[model samples]
Target: MPKFLIQATYTAEGTQGLLEEGASGRRAAVEQVVSGLGGTVEAMYFAFGEYDIVLIVDLPDASAMAAAGLAVKASGALHTRATPLLTLDEADEAARRQVRFRAPGAQGPAGA
Candidate 1:
């Protein structure tokens, strides 16, 4: 399973709905959506800054996560951003891989 971090900000109408339904209702709704997409919500929280809410979820794959994001966006109530989270082991594996590349202003192999 792949993990995703979701940061969202509510529109005026969405804020009004939030006030009416409250946080618990919103959390449950999100949980249900994620579950329907074969994912689980690891954690969710309300924030007081650039983002109104944040969530961590474990989903089956990128497409599943994208589906979840698109569904939310389609509601026209909130703006959402989803970022894929890589585990430390995955980072380590990436760091260990080797390849060849040229820096800016540099030529190709052997400077040819």
Candidate 2:
């Protein structure tokens, strides 16, 4: 399974709804949605400032995350951003991959 970090900012209408239903209520709704899509909500937090809610979830794939994002955004209550998350080992593996590259305007071969 793949994980995602989702950050959400509620609109005025959404904020009103949140006030009525409460954070736990909202969290439940999210969990339901995620579970329906074959995923699990690992952690959820209600916050202030730039973002109102943040969630870490594990889904079967990126497409599942996209589906969740699209559905949530289409609701018109809040805006969302879903970012794929990589575990430390995954990051280490990525770091170990071999690649040769050169910056633009840096003459000739990369090591030349």
Candidate 3:
């Protein structure tokens, strides 16, 4: 499973709903939504900054993440951003891959 870090900022109407429903209610709603998308909410937190909530979620793939993101954004209650997270082993593997590349103004291939 792939993991994602989601950051969300609630709108005034969203905050009003939260105040009425409470944190646990919100958590349950999130859990239900994620589960329906073939994912699980690993962790969630409320913060005081540019983003109001942060969540770590595990989903089967990028498409599932996209579906979840679109669903949330379509609600018009919150602004959400999702970033795919790579595990340490995945990062190491990516770093080991080799590729031929040239920066701007660099020399072309030997053939021209």
lDDT of 1 by residue, 48-89 (tens): 999999999999999999898888899988999999999999
lDDT of 2 at 13: 90
lDDT: the better of candidates 2 and 3: 3
Cα lDDT of model 3 by residue, 1-112, tens digit: 9999999999998999999999999999999989998889999999999999999999999999998889989998899999999999999998888756776787863322
Best by lDDT: 1
Q: Please report how far candidate 2 places residue 67 from its true position, in Å.
A: 0.4
Please, what is the whole-model Cα lDDT of each candidate in the order they appear? 0.93, 0.92, 0.93
RMSD of 3: 2.9
Estimate the TM-score for candidate 1: 0.92
The residue pairs that clash in candidate 1, if any, are none
For candidate 2, which ten residues in a row score worst on lDDT?
Answer: 103-112
**Cα shift from native, residue 21, model 1 (Å):** 0.3
Pick the winner on lDDT between candidates 1 and 2: 1
What's the TM-score of each model vs. the native?
A: 0.92, 0.92, 0.91
Badly placed stretches (over 4 Å) of model 1 are 109-112
